[model samples]
Target: MTVVSSVKDLEALTLTIVNEFDAGVDRVWQLWEDPRQLERWWGPPTWPATFTDFDFTVGGEARYHMTGPEGEKAHGWWRFLAIGRPASLEIEDGFADANGEPDLSQPSGRMRVSVEDLGGGRTRMTIASHNDTVEQLQELIEMGMEEGMKEALGQIDAMLAE
Candidate 1:
């Protein structure tokens, strides 16, 4: 597992996960830049993500769904707020309806992702998921956000190795 740390800071209303990859920033960047690469590891093995529309630009939206082992589907969407090539990105992530449209009933959160070259053909990726309130943060943690993300990110090392 590449995850060095997974912290849920209710004080900061953020759930942050840090991972180190045995690849350069540019190489790791492709995981997020390309929808195909992203879908390869964006969800846990039991529930794989499949992107329907991916526009990798500021203000662009990416919509996808994770199909569970039982044939159930969990929809999701991301709107890019900021994109810094090979470095950082900020996006609003949320649950979506069956049609892949934003599900307003579910809370929407902002996630900031930063990639840093650790040198020696290695890199560090820090992802901070920000919630609007402590209640919201606690709610997400209770929903197993931390564990789900850890599982989702666990597949990255294998993909990077390829």
Candidate 2:
């Protein structure tokens, strides 16, 4: 189990997930660089994700959908704000409508992902999700974001092994 821990801070209005993988930073970074690898672990096992459009560059966008066990779909989109190769990435993430457009009515989160080389062929990944308000943060938590993220991240270990 590579997922180390998850912490939610109401005062900071952020959720952070830390994971340590038994692979090099570059190898682990490929999970985000390659759409196929990304799709394999972007969502929980029960709700596998499928990326329709993925542009892993600054100022680019990514559109994906997670299909639930009952065949229901949850659409989402990401607007890349910054990218620093295998080290870090910053993006604005939000829910999208069936038409693949962002739903302004819903709250969006600013996410920063950082990958650090831990030596010994190990990498430590940190995902920090920041919300605009505590209420919004609570809303997402109530919606099971923590568990979903933990489950989603748990899949990465297997992907990296292969």
What tens-digit string does per-residue lDDT give for candidate 1 at 1-162?
Answer: 899999988676788999999999999999999989998887766667899999889999989988766687777789999999989999998878878898878778999999999999999999998877665555444333444565668778778888
lDDT of 2 by residue, 1-162 (tens): 878999988777788999999999999989888989998877767667898999888899999888776687778888999999899989898878888888889878999999999999999999998998766556444333445565678788778888
- TM-score, per-candidate, Cα-based: 0.79, 0.79
| CA deviation > 4 Å runs, candidate 1 | 133-162
Question: Model 1 compared with the native: what TM-score?
Answer: 0.79
Q: Over the full model, what C-alpha lDDT does candidate 2 score relative to the true structure?
A: 0.84
Displacement of the residue 18 alpha carbon in candidate 2, Å: 1.9
Which pairs clash (backbone N, Cα, C closer than 3 Å) in model 2?
Answer: none
Model 2, residue 21: displacement in angstroms?
Answer: 1.1
